[model samples]
Target: MKKDQLYREDYFTCPIYFMDKPEWVKKLNKASDLYIKKAQKNNQPNIKERTKKFGNKGDHGMVHHSTSLINDPKFIDLQEWILATAYNLLDEQGFDLKGYQLFLTEMWVQEFSHLGGGHHTLHTHWNGHMSGFYFLKGSERTSCPVFEDPRPGRQMNLLPEKDKSKVSLATSQIHYKVKPGRLIFFNSYMPHLYTVDNGYEPFRFIHWNIQAIPKGVLNINKE
Candidate 1:
């Protein structure tokens, strides 16, 4: 009789995709700056600030004006590229994108200036299938984003890793260091946050949410 060695299989793994677009980074940065200045002059509120980190209040959540920005010529090309990349990702993940009508539910920009300290608390996006971020500007001093394990209960009993790989480790959270022009996409249910800023400069990024509706589900043509 021959002895058989058992192999471990990974299941229910989290998926994340990253891409780089230098051209879009430049355009987004310029557009973001313009909008930020305009919003400040107009006394627009920053609705996306949840942590209340120290900084110029107007600098955060400036992208809530996504509707207008999307229409702006400065952002149209970048928006189209983001959509195309997202569709490619979905197709690679075995999703038949042709079967559904995809819609962009929300698109926004977040800027965290390290006046003292700035960070976002762990949270998940709602009312969307996917959430993503495109880094318009980043620095080595800026802390990376982290994702928490969705299964908190499973983490109660941890086992030592036989392999030294970070992905194979039984860790509750993982962090990713990103640079300018980097784009990341992940599931909406994944809880994630930006680590505390240790850098002096502002860390800026564009965030967006996507939703897919099956074709003809609403049946509006019959009316």
Candidate 2:
């Protein structure tokens, strides 16, 4: 057979949906400082300084993930509802989970502390077909989620004589100024970057990573 398709059917060229979440503001803020502190302490690094090189391979922000969060009651409580809401939104967008044999395999929160901005990146879950982020906090600035324009080239002004328009096309980074409880979902391969800037307050955020896989294609390993 020919080479398998590089991406699943949902490998998106353009992100499908956006949901405004004003309710989770309080809950996220209440746990924000605690999550950041705990993550820094456990990782044995100053988040402010460590995540400075956010865009490079030596990205320290990547270290905060731990499977133990699955057992924490708080994590479970928040994640349960958060996930339900996300999937509902996805379904409303015409992605039929039942027909596609799709289901979530794992979910977790990523806590980014002072100046903790992700460099340009994309997410690919081990068995996931699609992934997204639930913006908890610290996304108010000009650079919460930046979607890369796939088409990048210079266009010729062919019809310039009749229509007064310059037709030069180039892929520019579109910045999303996100609010406290907004969700952005996209295909795993869509290139994106979380921006970093200088500010007085530490950048605190919680990102929920979701993994969707076809049934019978994945198995749970206790280890």
**1-223 in candidate 2: lDDT tens per residue?**
4588575353424554577777876776675556555655666654445556453333333434433344456656666765676567567767777634344455555454343443436333354545666666554542366665443331232222342243222333456666667766665545566765333233434554555554445444322
Give each model's whole-structure lDDT. Answer: 0.70, 0.53
Evaluate residue 105 in candidate 2 and report its C-alpha lDDT on the 0 to 100 scale. 50
Measured by TM-score, how close is model 1 to the native structure? 0.78
Candidate 1: Cα lDDT at 174: 78
- lDDT for each residue of candidate 1 in 183-206, tens digit (9 for 90 to 100): 889978889988878656667788
RMSD of each: 4.7, 9.6
Residue 24 lDDT in model 1? 75
Pairs with steric clashes in candidate 2 = none
Q: What is the lDDT of residue 116 in candidate 2?
A: 43
